[model samples]
Target: MTIAEVSKKYGLSADTLRYYERVGLIPEVKRNKSGIRDYTEEDCRWIEFIKCMRSAGLPIETLIEYVRLVQQGDETIDARKELLIEQRKQLIEKMEDMKKTIERLDYKIEIYDQAVVKKENGLKRTYD
Candidate 1:
């Protein structure tokens, strides 16, 4: 598929796709004779992986390193696994922190709700 098609399909801007190639986040895409990018299935797979990692808050440098390791053939398998494990640990920590924050907010909201209910009840008693 052309770059435009890939961009539309992946919900990424054309410029972002080009930037990913330039930054080595993805392997160089093949171009047709007319100089248009022709993305392959493998390229789409890389895009999906990169998008997922980015959404998970993985650092760009870490992703670049992972891509480099992938290009280095089979010798980097253990290294890649270690990298992924470390990233997963960090993501889990972040999730835990976010969970705590959500719980705190919920508690605050519940307190306000109870206060409102109490005030309404007091007002009704005063009126009656």
Candidate 2:
């Protein structure tokens, strides 16, 4: 598939995909004779993996390192697993913080809801 096709399939802009390649977030893509990118299934798999990691808030520098490790062959398998584990740990912490924030917002909203109900009840009593 072409870059545009990959971009649409992955929900990322073409420029972002190009930047990912340029920044070494992904390995180099093979170009056709006409100088257009022809993404193979393996290339698409890398793009999908990169996109998933990015959405999970993994740092670009870390991802680049992981990609470098991958290029080094089987020796870096443990390193890659460790990197993923660390990122998952961080994500869990972030999720906890977000949960607390959501709970606070819900509490504030409930307070306002109760106040509005009380005011409405008072208004109804006055009218009656």
Candidate 3:
């Protein structure tokens, strides 16, 4: 497929795809004899994976480092694994905090429900 087809298929801007290529976020794309980017399914697959990681809150710099490590062959395997593990730990911590926040919000809503009910019953109250 062409770049436009790739962009539409992935729902990414043409410029973003170019930027990814330029920034080393993606591997060097093979071009045809006519100097057009002839994208293959494999290229598209990597684009989709990069898109997923980006959507998952992975930083571009981290992604760049990861791509670099990947291109370095097998020597950086341990570092890549450690990076993923660390990020997973952080994500878990963030999710736990979000869960606590949601619980607090639900608790507050319960209190607000009581206040509204009491107000409807003509039992006025003041809060400091």
Candidate 4:
């Protein structure tokens, strides 16, 4: 597929795709004879993986390192696994922190809700 097709399919801007390639966030894309990018299935897979990792809040440097490791062949298998494990550990910690924040917000909202109910009840009593 062309870069435009890939951009539309992946919901990324064309510039972002170009930037990813330039920054080594992804491998270099093969261009057609006309000097236009023709992304392959493997390229799309890398984009998908990179998008997923980015959404999960993985650092760019971490992803770049992971990609580098992948390019280094089979010797980096254990290293790759360790990197993923560390990232997972960090993601879990962030999730836990977000959960705590959500709980706190819920509690605050419930308090406000109760106060509103109480005020409405008091007003009804006064008017009646």
What lDDT tens digits, residue by residue, belong to model 1 across residues 65-96?
A: 99999999999999999999999999999999
Which lDDT tens digits does candidate 3 get at residues 1-115?
A: 8899999999999999999999988998999999999888888878997999898788899889988999999999999999889878877897899999999999888888888
lDDT of 3 at 72: 98
Off by over 4 Å in 1: 123-128
So what's the TM-score on candidate 4? 0.94
Candidate 3 lDDT (Cα, 0 to 1): 0.89
Q: TM-score of every model?
A: 0.93, 0.91, 0.85, 0.94
Error of 4 at 22 (Å): 0.8
Q: List the residue pairs that clash in candidate 3.
A: none
Instruction: Tell me which of candidates 3 and 4 scores higher on TM-score.
Output: 4
**Model 4: per-residue lDDT, tens digit, 46-104?**
99999999999999999999989999999999999999999999999999999999999
Per-residue lDDT for 1-128 in model 2, tens only? 99989999999999999999999998999999999999999999999999998998889999999999999999999999999899999999999999999999998888777777879888432211
Look at candidate 4 and tell me the lDDT of residue 39. Answer: 99
When 1 and 3 are scored with lDDT, the better candidate is 1
| Model 3 per-residue lDDT at 99 | 100
Clashes of each: 0, 0, 0, 0
